[model samples]
Target: MRFIIIGAGRVGLRTARVLRQEGHEVTLVERDAEKADRARGLTFEVVDGDGSRESVLQDAGVADADAVGALTGDLNANFAACLIAKHHGCRTVMRIDEDYREEIYQQYADEVDEIVYPERLGAIGAKNALLGGSIQAIADVAQSLQIVLITITDGSPMKGYTLSEVALPSDSRILAFGKANDPLGIPLPDDSLEAGDRVAVLAEFSELTEVRQLLVGDESAAAAVAGGE
Candidate 1:
């Protein structure tokens, strides 16, 4: 897919790099001459103008873009770029620094296809690194729910059990499971739960402790693993 990114800052540059790595085309719009030149130095096709302006967007080929991301630090500019992208019939994605504004922006979310809080994502990553658990939080889905990746430990009671036999907590559900190094797949009722396998689960915060205890064994086991890290 073709994407137009409205910024040449860290997030915009990284996003373009990953999309390009996934075989997508990207054009970046940056008003800062130095930032635009830096992006160009990295071989990125950059439009040297303000992304919030229609004329600048037109120069970046917004009409031909499949999607446009307003990823600048400036929320007003991001919103403006998204509105123009929407007008051009392109999928719009807006980035915001503050998660506190999610509710306010969500009210007008129809203007953009997606709204993301990079700070919240960074918090999740940091939490995962600091929290020593068999279950590492991948995302906070809602106020009380989390998306987690649970690793079935070598000595876990979950080993040799099937999905249904595991009798997961009421507030938790297994999304997928497979070998630790393998991509997750649908958890068949009869599929064996092997040690070192990993499962992605959606779980309530309150139920995570029990969920970890069941799959990872005891607190001692969790502590030992943390100690080794």
Candidate 2:
């Protein structure tokens, strides 16, 4: 696959390197001469110009790209670049920095292929830091869903339960499970949940509280359930 990434910043550069390492063709577009020169040093094809401009993107072969990631820190530039990429028949992903504006931009998410929130993910990291132990968010699957890895502690309601016997909220389901220290893999129906084992679950945004309560009995989960009233 050929990917054109706008912005030669940390996110764009690292994304290009990883894609290149996977044997995909990657081209990076940057407006700054210094950044373009820096990208060239990394052995990636670099285009020095404003990514938001159609001509600049065209010069980077956006029309032939399998995918385009508009990852500049500037939101407007990223959005404009994505529009151009979408017009050129490339699947597009735009990086958004503000969480509050997510819903407004998400109205156009279907027009593009995806939207990313690196800043919001950083916030989630901060949340995990404060929450400490047991529960950890793995990724935001969508605006209303999250994939999380939870450890089964001794007092967890899920501890000692079999995979087939655990009751998840209607909006949630277990995606995978594995014993602690084991290579993470999909859980089998016969597998029993043991203390120290880890489970990965996909839950709707509204059901996260219940899901957490069932797993770790966290106070926030209980509070959420109460507040839902």
Best by TM-score: 1
Model 1 pairs whose backbones collide = none
Q: Candidate 2, residues 1-229: lDDT per residue as tens digits?
A: 9999999998889889999999999999999899999999888899999999999999999878999999999988998898889889999998888776777777846656787777777667876776667877887777778888888888788778798898899999899898988976988988898888999999887887888888887644633321121
> Under the 3 Å rule for N, CA and C atoms, how many clashes does model 1 have?
0
Residue-level lDDT of model 1, residues 68-175, one tens digit each, is 999999999999999899999999999997877777787766878888888777767766677655667777777678878888877788888888898889989998
Each model's lDDT comes to 0.84, 0.84
TM-score of candidate 1 against the unseen true structure: 0.88
RMSD of each: 3.8, 3.5
